[model samples]
Target: MKKDIFIPKVENVYIAVVNEYNEIYNSQDWNAYIINNKDVDLEMVLIVTSGYNEGKITSTFRKKLERLPAKNYAKIELMQEELFALNNTFKVSFFEGNTMYDKTFLFRKNTINLKALQPIPLMDVKGVLVK
Candidate 1:
């Protein structure tokens, strides 16, 4: 057997939106998910950054991922409509084993455009406990 070998990469992590009722959100109650498709478990910090030169849009939640198991996901309670007005990106710092990884993924501009976004699935939905 191949043992399902997979090389863990921090860049593979991505964001998604899931509604509170496990259904399509009605302009609110949408959550932001960080899906991890790696071979190792990770703990991470997620911060949303946006806005103009002077006034910056900072995430008050300061979402944290205590444990993102291999091939699993965790999410934060972030509304989709709230981020559509500004350009948003996620600055993620995660630790896998003894090594640290950092990267940023564009959300609002490329992915989360409420004005033009339609239903699309990027990855499989696998749930994990998130702190």
Candidate 2:
């Protein structure tokens, strides 16, 4: 029989993806801040923390560092109304030209700008696989 890993789940957690220089690239639904480009092309660290107690929970993404040494990551910033976007789902595609990304890039929300936006940029994509 396999033993289960006793990982505790917490609410209101904060996640930030930083480079080796500690520049904030990506973050969770909240707390997204602008990052300096000088911190790019360094090791990427994904930090997951507990919200209620304010403690670190898990760290992942070292594998990505070994693969793409000079790659940059960006965190999505959520505005006051943009907080709703965290719960939404969207699709991605590789279509190009005037008909660029027609079918598979539909966003879930019905807001004006949100309705016609693609979450992830498709151009110059190296890898699209989720860990």
Clashes (candidate 2): 2
lDDT of 2 by residue, 1-131 (tens): 24674423221111221112224754322222112122223233232211111232222111111211222344433323342332222222211222222111112232323233323222222211111
Model 1, range 1-131, lDDT digits (tens) per residue?
A: 56785434566666665544444544435566776766777876555544322355654456776788888766656665556556555567788777777766665433444343344233443222121
Off by over 4 Å in 1: 1-9, 19-28, 44-60, 110-131
TM-score, candidate 1, is 0.61
| Each model's backbone clash number | 0, 2
The lDDT for every candidate, in the order shown, is 0.57, 0.25
Model 1 residue 52 distance off true place after TM-score fit, in angstroms: 5.2
Error of 1 at 45 (Å): 4.1
lDDT of 1 at 104: 68
